[model samples]
Target: MNGANMSARLKDKIICITGAASGIGRATALLMAREGALVVATDLQADTGAALAGEITQTGGRAIFLQHDVTDEDGWREVIAIIRARHGRLDVLVNNAGIGLSGPVVEMSLADWRRQTAVNLDGVFLGVKHGLPLLRQSGGGSVVNVSSIAGIKASANAAGYCATKAAVRQFTKAVALECAAAKDNVRVNSIHPGIVETAIWDSLIGTTQGARGTRLEALTAPSIPLGRTGTVEEIAAGILWLASDESRYVTGTELVIDGGRSIA
Candidate 1:
């Protein structure tokens, strides 16, 4: 089918995405809107988040920006409440907000670890804890948590990042089983992206090989079997599938878009 026909896959769906100011979240929000879903984009960054909403509106897509910090339980509550009040139903929750602190575990401070945990793992937890209710109320939907290849494959200096992402992976399966047993019609799944070309990589760039100004391509060349990094658009496409009915039978699974790095 053509792009127009394909774009209607999520027609009239209600989608709320966290960490949507930039990176994968931004791409997912834009893609979902094009698919005819009403996008509620949330992030801690007020300015860029609003700009994202404006960009979507200019393109004739429905979207709204909300300032949200995923680690705040009360904030999650309010975001979902507002969605319930205005839209009356929510079809998908994309817990895409996260951060990575690339360093040796010994040198990492407790506060830094906690901060990473709060966003990478706790954020996803809160999204499901609150978003699942509205999802069930909508008669069933999907929750797409953005995990990473670090979740499954071990790396040298990314212990904390891996820990949180791994937690998200396992948490997804547990919730998926719970939802299935209760027949709530909600599917929970995790997306494990390897090395995506996003802002997140900027911090990770100099951590390895002691090269402070090493290019991403140079770092990825010897590692990623596909000879390149993934893109936010590619990652967003996987997330879109999970959010759409096309993945109705898929849950409690990890959609790895890592270009063979995980296997390598």
Candidate 2:
């Protein structure tokens, strides 16, 4: 089969991505649009998500922006209902909204723990809970959850964040098995990223050092084994593969895009 005809893999497929205001989520929206998916770019930042959707529209790609708070089950349900009503099916669901909470467990409060899990773990759970039916309606689609290298391994002073991300990894596996066992034609997977140069990283640095200039570069270049942090586009490409038919046999796998940091 011609690659064009055979692998317009996502042509006309509807994909919904959370956290689309910036970082990996934004990148995925653009990349998926380029690959012929009807992208729904959503985030709490209404302005940014709208701008991204507009850009895609200007480029002659189909897209919509929905304001979403991942922690709100009602919001997630609304999103799916609207998508189904408007677009008819949800082919790909990307759970990409997350926050970076840094502090030692001893100093971390219940609020901190809850906040992290609410967005990272519980948010993913909600997506799967609500999205599975839609994905099955598409005759089997991919669910890509954004995890972290921190999920696979622990870091110093990031107990709450690590715990939530770890939950996402395991949750993806468990859910993938559930889908397969039900033979529901829905695939679930996770992406584990290391120090990716995202707005989240900038915000984390701003919270700590009060300046993201040199500190950001140092974090990107020094610690990672590849001598550089991953890019949002790089991570988006991984998501595209998982969401596309090329990865049909690849469910429940964690695609780590951390510039080889996990190898070290």
In terms of TM-score, which candidate is strongest? 1
lDDT of each residue in 72-136, candidate 2, tens digit only: 99999999999999999999999999998886688988987898889999999999999888889
The all-Cα superposition gives candidate 1 an RMSD in Å to the true structure of 3.0
Across 1-264, the per-residue lDDT of candidate 1 in tens digits comes to 224544697899999999999999999999999999999999999999999999988878899999999999999999999999999999999999999898899999999999999999999989999998899989999999999999999898899999999999999999999999999999999999988667777677644433422477677757989888788899999999999999989999999998899998
Which pairs of residues collide in candidate 1?
A: none
Error of 1 at 199 (Å): 1.0
Q: In model 1, state the lDDT of residue 193.
A: 91
Off by over 4 Å in 2: 1-7, 207-213
Please identify model 1 stretches exceeding 4 Å from their true place: 1-6, 206-214
